[model samples]
Target: MTYWNQEIETMDPVRLRGLQSERLVKLVHYVYEKSPFYKKLFDEKGIKPEDIKSIGDIQKLPFTYKKDLRDTYPTGMFCVKNTDLVRIHASSGTTGKPIVVGYTQNDITNWAESLARGFTSVGLGKDDILQISYGYGLFTGGLGAHYGSERIGATTIPISSGNTERQLSLMEDLNVTAVLCTPSYFSYLIEVAEKEGRSLKNNKSLRVGIFGAEPWSESLRHRIEERSGIKAYDVFGTSELSGPLFTECPEQNGMHVWADMFIVEILNPETLEPVKDGETGELVVTTLLKEALPLIRYRVGDLASIENTVCACGRTHPRLMRLTGRSDDMTIVRGINVFPGQVESVLMKIPEVSPHFLMMIERNGELDDMTVQVELNDLASDKVEDYNRLISRISHDLRTVLTLSVDVELVNPGTIPRSEGKAKRVIDKRKF
Candidate 1:
């Protein structure tokens, strides 16, 4: 019932690299001529478009960062004609200006097909009614998942996001077979279902879940599966690239990247050179067959490692390790590096605490201090002793794991801000 060629998905590694190189050369030449941003970059480096002959030559191209896209603003990096663009999406520029990404009619089709391939890779097909909870408009999650459902001949209820009551209503009434959203949102949904005395296990239609847009640990995945009555798969991508660039198969080893569309590499962030297999580094992607916004060696700040081998499920497309975190999102406290995912892993272990939380970093007397503000479950709010104990436990955990102490504040329900899209977990009050 799926549209993708199984043979292509499991193509031999040798042939896959050859196909990628051939496509990359064409993509580079096309973008160099059509995109002003790429043209300027190549010219500045004294590199000719024809100089890019193979996938290996991709390293010779200057890397495009998020800042470059921001500088280009709305439509400066668009490679195709304006009339060819059928859709547009933008990342929530909470930190600065939003980076815009445009999709041509073909680009849209390619994205939908690729997403459909991802869905099928994780065992979704025509029988499922997918409930898409990812927000629509400016964000790419909704439309990207919607198209995949339609392509697979499944009924897609484009419910978008929020309106939790309505979302649950549809899940129950419509017998929704699958759900898609960020891991955090899914966690929050489980809590809501439990509070209302609804049993997720009793819901027969619920089966598989595709979650991403935020880094999540295996503990979180197990938590979601235990509470939501579904097999959780990590869906990885960004607004810059069409969403669903990589996805985990049923085996859940690592997400398989579409080598035909994307040439992926793990690079040393400091050296900007390729890292050895099994080594963590920044993820760099070069779009192979893109017509619009063809990015060559674009440095997506996410940290991960390359996995090339036959999976237990028999897929041959190179696998990408679950995104560890982002280079830009790392926090240094007392000379110790900390990631929010690490903090979340610790917080989830506490039974009384709610999933909604925030990390506040500020400078105090020329030294940095972090305060983890977390909301507790409603039933445990009145127990002051329990609250103090929870805070003490968290502080001790942080001190042991991160080698740094932090103030842990237990807040009331609804005190922490809810995110409709990507959650804002960190607030750095220090003026830099």
Candidate 2:
């Protein structure tokens, strides 16, 4: 299957904006007519489809949050008939409710095509044997990755998450040339293999690894590549946005957005105004072409920026900088916004700290409490004086950047539990 529309992906910014405006106008009308939730919202707000003449007019539309989905419950927000929906996927109910997304047969096919593009962008093809380690059922990650590999004509080994021994045994027996899994589990798999006296670096068959479902630094990417003897690439998307919205090419500078399907925008989370090119802001997405559950101007909560400059890979589709952090993940402590990813970055830069760390935010008495629970690589080498000194430096760094003070405690490595899926890095112990 060739590209759906080549010119649109390579369209210049000026023309691209025009295409987005036209599509956005049509989508607004479609949603208003078909979706009850949106119809009531538009009528109550005295808004008309004609009011949205351009993409800039999206600000006039009310922001649709995860809470809106839950308030509508199972089927109230559905734009199409139940018979039209080919699949349903839901996230874990972590913060009170799990967001549910529905897809038509066309929607599922489009999703596979998008993911297939991601695999092809990283040189995955029939010659590659893919071992998928993501969890299947309910959750979208596993099926999305699996179907994408199938669409790309790769030999797939459906090795679901966990079960490290079986995963390794298949890798050796099948001589798996590539693996698709979360970055955290991939790291843990390598760690377990070493303890079992297995060799991953010496495996000549492995060629590439596609890691995602969490935020990871370039440092972590290098570590994965070194340990697994393969090139590591990043993939980005959410269940609401349809997986494989963007993916890294061979160059690995940034991920390329599939512009033909998604009209990606970076807007200031507070102001709701578009950020200039190259400026970081919360990612706002508008589905240019979707039949079922087409979310218009959906706030993804992911913070990132877009670059229009052409890539060395010769795909003129815009590039997105690696995700910095999520808007939901940002904590307001004493009127200052702090991100756990920032704390993780700082901790990772320090050689003594282990990769596993947690940021705890709670109420101590009346005041808000912020503390970084760091796992030290060597327990024997850890000292109270050293902990104090290092935490002081970290406190200074936070005060300099975020204008907030925090406490840091050094704990032994392996004290914190590892996450096979999405890592829980932040713990808000504050009670309402």
Candidate number of the best TM-score: 1
Give candidate 2's whole-model lDDT.
0.78
Writing each residue's lDDT as its tens digit, candidate 1 over 1-432 gives 232668788789889889998998888778878988888888999999788788778778888888888888878888987788888888866556789998888788878877777788777888889999998878888888888789888889999989987888889999998999988888777777777888677788899999988888776787678777799999898888886557788888788888888888898878878888889998998887767787878888889998887877777888888777887788777678888888887877776676678999999988999999988876575777877777898899867877888998888877887775677789888887
**What TM-score would each prediction reach against the true structure?**
0.94, 0.88
1-432 per-residue lDDT for model 2 (tens digits): 234344554567677777778888898999999998899989999999889998889788877776777887776777899889988888655456787888888888888877777678777888889998888877778888888889888998877788888988899889898887878788777766766778688777888888887888776676667667889988887877765456788889788787767777889878888899899988888787777778777888789998978877766778888887777777887667887667766765666665677888989887898888877654336567877887777678656666778887778766877777777888888887
Q: Per-residue error at 303 for model 2, in Å?
A: 2.0
Clash totals, every prediction: 0, 0
List the global CA lDDT of all models: 0.83, 0.78
